[model samples]
Target: MKKPKPLRQEQILGELNQAPSLRVAELARRLAVSTETIRRDLDELTEQGLLNRTYGGAVRSLGTEPSVTERHTLFVSERERIARAAVPLVKDGRVLMIGSGSTTVHVARRIAVEMKNVTVLTHAFGVATVLAINPTIKVIMLPGDYHASEGATVGAHTVSFLQNFHADYAVLGASGLGQDGPADALIECAAVYQAMVSQAARTVVVADRSKHDRLFPARYAHWRDIDRVVTDAAVGSALAEPFRQFGVGQVLA
Candidate 1:
């Protein structure tokens, strides 16, 4: 029996809900359909705004695509605590690379308002705009194609430009994580983060419990990239010692 297109689309969404991402080949195999058929379904889903098209795949997009303003409300208290815990780790008068994400933006807000005489290189307009009030902090915005919804600049050009500089620290954020470090849903954002990990002397990943144990399509950094993790107490205990084994200090907020 031939399954209806709507039914197959529903199944695709259902599978994506569990895995968060699906490659074309894998989805095609699972659905028992030709790769071209799956690709056509992905196109329809993406056009309807039910999914976001990625390279060779599609990811579940129900609530993950919210703007920064919307995201700030989702994890209010947790983000506040994470920001406070992260502030102490940052030193004054050092060059830093700040990555995009609501939690990292909070860290930038803390740094901008409290710290003085530090240099920051960042791609997010949200982070830069928040830091604008601080006169002593030097916020250098990285140029690239802008994503208004993401409130940041991301693309090949952003990654290319970051290769020329080095920073004392890179404070990053992620949508998912594991023993391998942080991951992002979008490949372009992940690429820039990978560069951030390389451009800085040290890297610190800041995320709340929501990201714990989740898997994304793009795992940008390795365990070595993360020197410390400032997160909430809700993170799994089993991963605590593993984090420590890599010399990654876990700071629970």
Candidate 2:
């Protein structure tokens, strides 16, 4: 007779939450379980609306999409324009949280140069490292699973870290923005963004013109979640209307 399988549902759930997406084989290796066992667990989670079953793996139910780094290199000039518009919003002696992305990196660099006596919190290693050398600024990093490609930490650890602090403002970047809301490349990052929105007294979404009409895999923030949006003038009036409809304040540069 074959031996009965061990109950590994919690372990499987934990793994999926950490990585957001993982193949069955990878899950098995991580959990030291059989592929069939992982598959069964995935099915159960899918039924519970906690996981989404994909071709050969499972992704968090939030959505499956590319990473921020993958999208970063695609729109260099547009991102820079957005960054230029976002920088002036930072004020000295305020607590701020900045999200991760190449455009956000630009915002961080500008902040390092222009702002002082500010406490900045982030999950991006690149952002922390850049600002670390600034004597007048304090940088706090959230801990989580490191996504090497994007150079940011994500997952529950980051989420828990964000829950502890409230910020004066948050400057965030998005992969896509629709008439209804903002979306992100990955479910995990979206969760992080959502947390940032809640913890910040004011939230500003920094996006380039190219991201205005695009829709990514996950909708993380509604139009109302942002207090203000800073983007380039290239974001045409038509695309900016939805933000206004949602009562979001807009600043174009």
Candidate 1: where is the Cα deviation over 4 Å? 1-65
In terms of lDDT, the best-performing candidate is: 1
- Encode model 1's per-residue lDDT on 102-206: one tens digit a residue: 899899988887799988999998889888889998988998998776788999889999999999899999877765677887777888899999999989889
How far off is model 1, as Cα RMSD? 9.6
The lowest-lDDT stretch of 10 consecutive residues in candidate 2 is 1-10
What's the C-alpha lDDT at position 216 in model 1?
Answer: 78
- Measured by TM-score, the strongest candidate is 1
Candidate 2: C-alpha lDDT: 0.76
lDDT of each: 0.82, 0.76
Q: Give the TM-score of candidate 1.
A: 0.73
What TM value does model 2 have?
A: 0.69
